[model samples]
Target: MVHSRVSINIDSWKKVSKANKDQIFKEIHHDYAVEDNIKKPLLKKLGKMHRDWRNRLRSGF
Candidate 1:
């Protein structure tokens, strides 16, 4: 059995205000923009696969 540990520094996070959270979200959104470009194509492919599966199920195949 493997155990994973999860620890959070609540005091440090509590020090962050709404402004800090907004700035962090802005930075994350910017980073996600880059990843989203790469992910878009993969997501489209997956969507197609999902549609195909749904169609097959509907057709009783």
Candidate 2:
């Protein structure tokens, strides 16, 4: 059997204020699934979360 490990940056989330965290969670929850049936996969290298993080900070995602 093969096991996979997933890691999240808790410190980063801790830095954000409660209100901002709520907003971020709401945004993420709503957009969790795309309206379009076709699904987009995250980049194999930087991964999905990082791509989303960068897009949120910058314009033109």
Candidate 3:
């Protein structure tokens, strides 16, 4: 599936469809490979984690 290059706000994550959310999770897992063996989390929790991670990365710079 071809994912668009649109930038989705973390706040909107929970509003997206389950398929889209799953795609997002798959993309993140593909890049980071950290979701292996972990139970999939709810979209809200996923968004929070993504937001926190982005903040940490930004702060480290």
Candidate 4:
């Protein structure tokens, strides 16, 4: 199967005005905090992965 690439150009922001930059930064920070909140459960799952891996290695899996 082939997958198409999706891309964003970060340097395009250089052409944006200062007011737009501030607004974008606020939105970015808001989204980041929301994302961190949403990822709490996934972070817990990651902790479990590490614990499971340790147990399997200890048991010579």
* Number of backbone collisions per candidate: 0, 0, 0, 0
- Candidate 4 structure quality by residue, lDDT tens digits, 1-61: 7643322232354556878767755655455565666655544564466557758978999
Task: For residues 1-61, write the lDDT of model 2, one tens digit per residue.
Answer: 7633433343366457888767755654465665433322321222446547767877764
Q: Which 10 successive residues of model 1 have the least lDDT summed?
A: 3-12
| Candidate 3 local lDDT, residue 43 | 39
Worst lDDT run of 10 residues, candidate 2, spans 37-46
- The candidate, 2 or 4, that scores higher on TM-score is 4
Rate residue 48 of model 2 by lDDT.
48
Model 2, residue 38: what's the lDDT? 32
State, as a TM-score between 0 and 1, how close model 2 is to the true structure: 0.36
How well does model 2 score by local distance difference test? 0.51
What is the Cα-based lDDT of residue 14 in candidate 4?
Answer: 53
Report, for every candidate in turn, its global Cα lDDT versus the true structure.
Answer: 0.56, 0.51, 0.58, 0.56
Off by over 4 Å in 1: 1-34
**TM-scores of all candidate predictions against the true structure:** 0.41, 0.36, 0.35, 0.40
Best by lDDT: 3
lDDT of 2 at 50: 59
In candidate 1, the residue pairs with backbone N, CA or C atoms under 3 Å apart (3 or more residues apart, or in different chains) clash, namely none
Q: What is the clash count of model 1?
A: 0
Winning model by TM-score: 1
lDDT of 1 at 44: 57
